[model samples]
Target: MKILLMLRDEFYQANPGLIEDAKKLGDVRILYTDQGIAKDELIKEVKDVDVILVAVVKIDQEVIDAAPKLKYILKHGAGYDNIDVEYAASKGIPVTNAPGVNAQSAADHAFGLMLAAARNIPQKDKEIKSGHWELSMGTEVYKKTLGIIGFGAIAKAVAKRATGFDMETLVYTNHRDLAEAEKLNVTFVDKEEIFKSSDYLVIATSLTAENRYLVNQETLSLMKPTAYIVNVSRGQLINEMDLMGALEEKWIKGAALDVFEVEPPINHLPGMREVVATPHIGGATFESIKRIGDLSIANIVKLMNGEELEHVVNGVHSRVTQR
Candidate 1:
């Protein structure tokens, strides 16, 4: 089997073991490119490859159509939105992701954002840097209500951390995991209630068509004026324009975001004081990268050996039979 690794240069450097393990399994090829490997280039790259591992690169129908020998696709992280899942399914190419690999790291980052926003950490730091002292009063987390938008692994981790701070946790998910919620002592509440009552609202859901603009203007209007919001999930989950409006009108006190609708150009949005933005570094920690790399390699090796994968996003047996 021939395996192609499509990742950034930094990731390649940090996870050298992935390349070595792939080499042991088959003829391994690594392409460190941020130009995103155009459809034609992807076709040429995967012409003779049996598997392709992708990060943020787009893997649409054109690329899938070009690779006849492609057996499986491994996404570096949990989100598979970059891949054409339906097309990959039709082509009988099973796709898998390293789910729960970076759950702790992402949850930690989400909490970091929450703390920063709640306590006005960034604003105070900025004031001190400018030679101002004892300028701002920040809110406390204890006795505050934390509303978690999604009840996934990351959300569970966040809830666990929040409980230690003596904050009440509320969760809202379409397909509620009652057992897990109860186990975490997370109060399962309606979305509107969460929006209205939360002192700190954290978004930890995956991006789907149904939730592209889950936190829109209408939803933002429902939030408390003193509340803070944190988003560590997909950027598009919150409408940027709507968020900007909220911040400008002081509908919400502040927001800390790790992801954005248009990354790198996130600064173009107004309301710098009200919004704390990071360049999508929720899962960029060394520990998380290593875990994701190792898990991705394991999934790839399993697929090559015709064994069951650990986290197959598409139906596992269906792909095998179709292929």
Candidate 2:
């Protein structure tokens, strides 16, 4: 048996123990590249491997088809959107991710962005560093309405922290699980209502085809002119062009995003000073990375030993057997 670990150099540098753990299961092969393994690269690297571990790399149908002996795929992070789920299911390969691994860190980053945007912290710091003392008036989070776009673990953490600021919380989820909503004291409302009523609208939803451009012109138009938007979720959820238009037109006061439609290209937007942006570092903390690495390795090890995985994305299949 063999396991191929595909990850960036940073991850490998942080968690050298994963390589030793993989050696216990099989001959371990490491691909320390973040550009993503192309189909041919995946084929060559995983040809004789029994398992594959990946992080932030696209695992499409072609890659799955190339590795005939591959049984399981372990994603280092919570989101498994980069993997082709239906195709992996068809191939009888189970995919698993480290859910809630970075929830706290991501929530903290979300709140940090909100605070920075609300108080103009970034602008003030920049001005001071450039030899000026401009004390601009900023809004307060207390006694304000906070609209959360998703009710997942990260959103729950955010809601918990929001209570400290005495902010009213409202949530919008597709399923609207009332029992869960009650626990957080968060009212379940329609998406439109959340958009219209929120002073600080936080986007924490997972990325899916149906809600890809959910925050386009119509939704932005409904928001208050003084409203601020913060997105720590997938960047594709908001249409970049529409967001740019909204900021330019002052449809909303501003936006603070840790993720963008085109990552690293976030700075390319004209007049981006109207918004605050980070380089998708919502889950980049050292603690979060360690948690994710440990969980991902554990999941893969369990699957290799014919044990149940902690966060299986696909239903149980008998295709993978321990040798």
Candidate 3:
């Protein structure tokens, strides 16, 4: 069996052993580039591979067509938006992601972003280093209304963390469960209500055609001027241009983002103290990467052995998996 592992150079360096571990199962080809692997080269690399493992590179119809022999596609982490699961499903090429592996890590990042944006943590630190000791007024998270966009694993984890801060979490999901809300001590609310009521808003929903740019002009208008927005999920979930306008016009006080519309966004988003940006490190914790790698490799092995797979997103029950 042959496998193609496409990852960022930094991620490969941090978890060097994953390649070696995958080697135990098949003829593994490791590909790395600081920027996502170029599509032309990716096509060449995947043409003959039986399985493909990905980080942030797009696995669209073109890439899928090139990988005629591909039996399975594994997203290195939870978010599979980078992969075209629908097209792969049509081709009988199963796709799976390491779902809960990075839940705690991403949840922690989301909460940290809320605190950093609300309290001007990064801004204050920069100001102090520059010999400006003036105290910047900041908001508190204590007893604040926290609005979350989705109730997935990471969302649930973030909600649980809010308990320690004594936050009131209002959740908005397409499919809501009253019993689940009661158990988690959160309230079910409409999207408009979440926007208008939250002191701090978090974008935790998965990116999709239906909800792309979910946070835009209309929603920003609903938020309080003192409110802050935190996003550790996909960048496309919030419209960057709209968000920048909102920040410039002071529609919302601040924003903290781990992902952006473009990775290493060409223009500095916000370009001010109010926005704290991290280079998509929500799932980069050492522990979380290891967990993601382990689960990913286990699924690859299951596919190779033709066993039942876990976290299969495309529901590909049977396929002519080539070796």
Per-residue CA lDDT of candidate 1, range 157-190, in tens?
9999997898899988886988887778889899
Q: What is the TM-score of each candidate against the true structure?
A: 0.91, 0.92, 0.96
Residue pair clashes in candidate 2: none
User: Which regions of candidate 3 deviate over 4 angstroms?
Assistant: 318-323
Clashes of 1: 0
Error of 1 at 194 (Å): 1.3
lDDT for each residue of candidate 3 in 87-178, tens digit (9 for 90 to 100): 99999889998887899999999989988888888888988999999877788999999999999889889998999999999999986867
| Candidate whose TM-score is highest | 3
Clash counts per candidate, in order, are: 0, 0, 0
Give the backbone clash total of model 3.
0
C-alpha lDDT of residue 148 in model 1:
95
Off by over 4 Å in 2: 35-43, 318-323
* Candidate-wise lDDT, in order: 0.84, 0.84, 0.87
